[model samples]
Target: MSRPNPAVFIAFLVAVIVVLGSVTLAKGGFYLAKHEGDTLHLLQILFRMASGEWPHLDFMTPIGLLAFAPVVLFLNLGLGVGISILLSQVLLAFILLPAVFWAGMSRLPRRAAYLFGLSVLVLVMALVHGETERSVSISMHYNRWAWAVSYVVIVLAVLPPREIRNDVLDGLIIGVGLAFLALCKVTYFAAFLVPVVVGLLANGNTKALRGALASGLAVALIVSVFATLDFWVAYLNDLREVSASTVRPAPGFGLRTIVMAPAYLGASAVALGAIILLRQAGEMTLGLALLLLAPGFIYVTWQNFGNDPQWLMLLAVLLLVPEVRPELRNSFGWPLAQALGVAAAIAIAFAAPSMLNLAYSPFRHLSLDPADYQPILVRNPEHHDLQVREIRANRVDGVVALDVPGSGLEDRVGKAKRDEERVSFQGTPLPYCELQMGIVAWFEAIVTDLEQNGFAEGRRVFVADLFMGHWMFSSLDRLEHGAPWYYGGLPGIDSADYLLVPLCPTSLSVRKDILETIEESGIAVTEVRKAPLYWLYSFDRDG
Candidate 1:
């Protein structure tokens, strides 16, 4: 038995680092900007968990709950977001490196194997870069990261080794890895299962097949039970609101879509052409071709078919090929084929990197200066002057509400008022109001925050809009009329204590009606200077 080449391992490690390092650096360029929803939400959950709070199921996406739980648990020792992301990326690279090395060793010569691994690394980097570039606005979405991680694991696990019996553990490990991937994103479950099923049928391993099937079913059962229970408990406690919303864009079978088939065919043809050229070189050359082609086929098919099982049929043709059989070892052509195969593999490996450099060039042109954006802590003098002073005086610890009024502020006020009207107009019909109120129903959040922070002792709470006062003051145990309403709601509508309401913009009837109701309800309304964007209204509930 030949000892494994240390060079192959070293090459694999270097490739993995290079791929991950480049992507991470590119992502870091946008660190000054706010992370997207997925990342923020994940970090929030992690923070809460680390602080000894139970992970809130409602706050997580279905698959995210599983993917985040371990990371949060591991990072509970006060690790920051940057450290957590780095750790995740490192784990992904380690998991991928072994598979690339094994796949190369099984099919190609040591040198060819190294080249094969290098090519895969380049392709993966290119794909990830493309995904990251497209996801700039939504960088916080953790699921994309989760999916990328799963893709790396799945490809490595599925690659066949040179000596199948020597690596019996690979299949079981793949099975367990697939289970975790399925838990994170159920769609990938098909990707692993289909290939396993095909391999079993081709090999005619009844006992092994039975075990794989049983294990898969057992995992599915356990996950489904847990998820169902979670949903029920979360919903009944009013901790989660479930709504069915979907985007079903019309399927386009355009010229571009048609063009994709030829591209894939061309890639496969090139890979096979390399294999034929390398035939005389050795069994390792053929094995390298099989390893690369197998995962690439699975990935391409899944991209097109949305993870259909029928696509596994393509692997059957691979099994039938004469060169794949163990008995045929060196029967194919030699020296000339080997040279051509090596040349082709090297060419294909360079393709992805060249394309990626072209794609990333545009982003590289932009300057990533933090000074371009305003600081979140900076006070807007026009709006925060009085409110900041008042907060300083009263020592309020929570968010200070502002009393700015403009079309933007009115939209929020109008939405709240309209939702309230819709609920009341319908005679307080339980479900009707519940469904129509949207997020506005959470008006109690302001008062809840205020009370929890002892804001009542200060006898005043800063607000962005006077309309927000309706919700805050109504919920307060006692109200103060002279208390200032801080202008904070819409940008450019900032005024301290003086409520700015823009009338040049058409008034939303809901805001107008709500204001009248507040006035009738004994909330004093003082109208001040009217600007093109907002009108000033001072409300003193204590009067």
Candidate 2:
């Protein structure tokens, strides 16, 4: 064997560095919750899993399991939240880049492949660091990553020259990849399936197709069986508790949001164009389409649900078109086709720079330290100047008793009694419990750390903001016990001994009510605070 081309090796190395560096920079300070509701659910799952409990169905996003389960199980090794998150980030970077590069290099010309790799790097960086609150955190968005991986697999699977000998293996690989992709986000399963089915029929191999179908069915059956078991044993129980709880529904994406729509359209157009170009280009088309569509498709999928079909459309375009193979180029005097190919390449290159720039700039900002600008906690006397101390804490494993203002039949009757004063309605649908855009990750890191440090079974009762309560406790746990404040109304005040609230500007603004609630309940609140900002709360059972 002759020595490998140094240029190709350099290109691959550069691609790897760019992808890894961008991801690392974008995820500066590790992962934090971009959405509170999702974070809470993640934390609940982490807590449950740590305690040998299975996750409920709603919490089991396929992407999350792919990225997080391994990290949570293997790498955590009983470390604090901050350390675990940092390790997870490292692991993600390592796993994501190689997989991405493998997908790109298998098809495109070396230069185009490198560019494609760079584009993926830029796109991920941009999304991770975008100022929009929804961009951060991958816990609930496992489908996005799965789609990226699947796009690559689909392209490669379709690229090889049709051969009976390779058919079974190819079918098996595609089937399995698609199955996993589907598990992560069911919508994506449809996208991959279209191309797989088309390829099987186009190849005219009944045995190969049947084997592929059987493998897919087997995988699906296995997953469904586990899912059903998990649901009956864990999810159903959680669901009932959540349904009966008084916590208001967390906000969702607004109907008028323009971001998801435009992104979808742009992605669809590019993906379709790529597929068309690839298919018309012949044998290399599948690989080319895969390389081109992976980044754009991943980005769009992360932003919205509808773009996966667009990716599939692109894949179809690649499969349906027939062009001269790269190796067969000298056999044909196809001047017009060659010109079209050159033109497509140029168009793709022209569009790439702007897209790369769009993805890279935002991530640069994410790497900055939040503490550089301001202290972690400010104002309130109880939490003032608390940033310097180290608060050794661990995840305390007790069922979080979350209460909403209007939870039960009895509470509704109580609402009628206090309707005249209007004070009863005042606290209904409490605003403080609402999930903030970027706080969930912080809470998760904290809880994860706390539990690993022997706090899993601790008796520290958290009397927290409505947002915190909603996120930290399951609906079932919240409903069965009323709010922590409700427990304060009991004969003894030992139930809600700790009140944890984030020390962001919003939390500082609500300092008065938070403190007043703690004081009126006769509980001594101690802020074990440290920060550029911190989650501030008092932790005393009795005043």
Q: Pick the candidate with the highest lDDT.
A: 2
Cα lDDT of model 1 by residue, 84-198, tens digit? 5444544544555665554445433444454444434433332222322332222322333333434333333333344433333444444545665555544455445565545
TM-score of each: 0.46, 0.51
Clashes of each: 35, 22
lDDT of 2 by residue, 1-543 (tens): 022244674566465556555555443333342333344444444444454533444332223234345436632376533334434444544455654455444434444445545544443333342223333343333543454456445544554332114456545655666665654444456545655565545545455567667777787677558555554444334434443433322123333332246634454455555555554455453545355445544544444532222233324323333445544333344443553455455445434444444354445335544443221122223222211111111211222113344554554555444322111111322223222343423444555544444332433434333333332421112212222111112211244434444333223223334445555766655655433323434455442
**Which residue runs does candidate 2 get wrong by more than 4 Å?**
1-41, 57-64, 74-76, 89-106, 115-141, 161-172, 203-367, 373-543
Model 1 regions lying over 4 Å from their true place: 1-7, 18-57, 60-62, 69-74, 95-160, 204-244, 248-543
Worst ten-residue run, lDDT, model 1?
382-391
Give lDDT: candidate 2, residue 47.
45
Most accurate candidate by TM-score: 2
**Candidate 2 root-mean-square deviation in Å:** 12.3
lDDT of 1 at 51: 51
